[model samples]
Target: MITKILPGTNIELKSGARDADLSVTGVVAMALPLHWGGRVTVIHAGDNTLYPLGYKISDPALKLVREVMNGAKQLILYRLNTVGAKASAEVSTGVTAEAVFPGTRGNDLSVVVSASGEKWLVKTYFGTQEVDSQIISAAADFSPYYVALSGTGTLAAATVKLTGGTDGAVESDYTGFFAELEKREYNVICSTDSDRAADVVSFVKEQNANRAYVQGVVTGVHPDSEAIYVCNSTGGVTADYELTPAESCATLAGLIAQAGVQTSLTYHRGITGWTDVKPHLTIDQQTGRTQNGEVLFVPLYGSPSVLYDITSLTTFDEDHPKDFGKGLVMRTLQKYQSDLQKLLDTRCVGKIRNSVEGRAQIKAMVFEMTSRGYLAPGYMEDFSADDITVTAGTERDAVSVVVGIKAVDTVDKIYVTVTAL
Candidate 1:
């Protein structure tokens, strides 16, 4: 159970409950928020110059460069797609337009879009963009753009300061949105008898429109969050899902992630199984319920989230990974059994490994505390104590330590070896 998400919404359909549809209408408001680290002063005032670090957009990123041209405000829609992964993907977003009502937290923006054409309203967003509404003012000859705004200030609010950026970067999500829409429409109607991808696509459509099915996609996706993200990928695409969702995108993302993975995930409300899917893992109901039975969900943007490192770190190499953390327990217990006395004796010396997945920079350190307990495999206490600095000779008071050696595949494990003193 990856319960890292903050309190929001948890929706699940019973095994066969309400085979009904919930066709949604226009978009009311969509939000995509990224939390910042606590503010800290970086420097003391020198000649009255106080230096501190603050989050700011760079000239290269998609979000920072897509502000509306009319005024300083960012357009809720645009005619172009700019930035993001180089390899383009076609995505479909159901919501088209939205509305905004002044409430407590600044005037909230609502989007109005069609959900199976019922005209739905969404006051919340997963990762939807405001650019979906930027239509060319004049259709045939490419004139100006018409964005809904009553007052001159509304347009004035659209102006953006010219931070050096390329004009070629039109708007974020534009390409993805259009590509997605075109693909989905084609998939729905294309007469391919064997391609069940259409069935899945149709299922998403029903989820949003009628009371029988729900349709959506994952947006603002990242390793830690499970929220589903949907995109229109059209000119300045529109969306309903975000990395942090107020609703179902979480479930949707989990499913997408699970479908593409070897392990499965279960919850109090529903169960997500990677069944009939490519390279999936199954529930180990026979040999007792174990997280080690499947995949190991690693966390990004933070501390170590791998539970059973000692064995999982070694057993599952790179390609043949034991999926979805189903095998977490077994892998973890194997380690615990090896050092039970040390684990139970709190005062004993213990060590852990540190790795930078893509970089392949592997390191380890000794620890003294258990900061958090998220898996059957224990976590380090005083978490930061992990992968401590090891220096040569007199660099950091080097101490002689005994080391245990073993091969990843060979069963003849464990041998005493000497380390830096």
Candidate 2:
């Protein structure tokens, strides 16, 4: 008899040493009218053709992008100006020079064609800065950013400043945009349109009825809407663009993504977006709004940064007097589903047989998750080896695995009792 070491055994030993890494699930999607970038279509982070957003306030495209990015790992921007009017070009008589894309920002652009010795000089100006300048004998070498050259006009030493450029009408194509967004996965989606935001929540529920739950954070239409809409009743108007309710929620989404899987947003100070939440809501009002499934930034002593994390979940939370309606719980559930799916799909699928050995592997991974604080330690005993059932499903080509998970929740409130002697 000889002792044999199997290749599979070696692989198992190596994999067992490493635990499953927690996945980040905070991708955001929104639609906006962007100037000079995107062809009235959907653009993702990897699209190099899309114009990049800058940190400058004058750049509306970049400003909006930065606003959403303040709370998301990545953003999927859809330029919603397909049927809308394009900004009229400030034509210099015979030239086809026009602002790229349709928007009001084109009004700021001006083009100047001058003669510099032999080569004709074409310069585009946005305010005092000369954005584009090119020396070309023909219109073929025109700058793409500022103007598109046209006509067979002969070269001349003359300058004409563009005029009569109008920002064309632009509208959000919510139906088309949402349909496209359905094909991908994102954690938080923020919208200022109340009707669209409500529809988003419905879509999220429908998609997550079986699995993959995503939360939609929207600006409330009113103070009494039953949704995860936030309010900024701050008395003073500050210049921070992030002070807007929608942007604030986007920031909160980012915070939740970076936070622990089992944490709550209660008392977690909002990021550097808002200076203060004013009009100091009474305790009763705050409680009522939360009961109606609305979130608000509360003023606490010197800071108005406290974000009360409440979900727009109305039906189930009312029946159960727990923190089930809290955004933290939804996030924890997302983490649990995402991590478990990853564990099963990557490690358990096809690698191990559906037998006692496979069941053991599943238990090991679950135990590891518990050890890492992703799952509650005290609930480990509930995750029995026998609890994991890998069996053939109703479909011939399908295998279903059923496993129980206990997610740890954050402590939001504390009550103390004092007895006087």
Best TM-score goes to which candidate?
2
lDDT of 2 by residue, 1-421 (tens): 2345755333222333565564546577676555544433333433333233211423434645554555555676666654434344423445466555545455566777787788888887766667778888876666576556776666565544544443344554477667777776666656655556656666656656656556566665433222243433322123443345554555455555445354566776644445666556788887876666666677665665544666665556454335456666556656567777777777777776656566566667765664564434332235544555666557654567676654455566789899999
The 0-to-1 C-alpha lDDT of every candidate, in the order given, reads 0.22, 0.56
Model 2 reaches what TM-score against the true structure? 0.74
Instruction: Determine which window of 10 residues in candidate 1 has minimal summed lDDT.
Output: 185-194
Steric clash pairs (candidate 2): 234-278
| Cα lDDT of model 1 by residue, 119-155, tens digit | 2221222123332343221112122111122221111
Predicted model with the maximum lDDT: 2
TM match of model 1 to true structure: 0.20
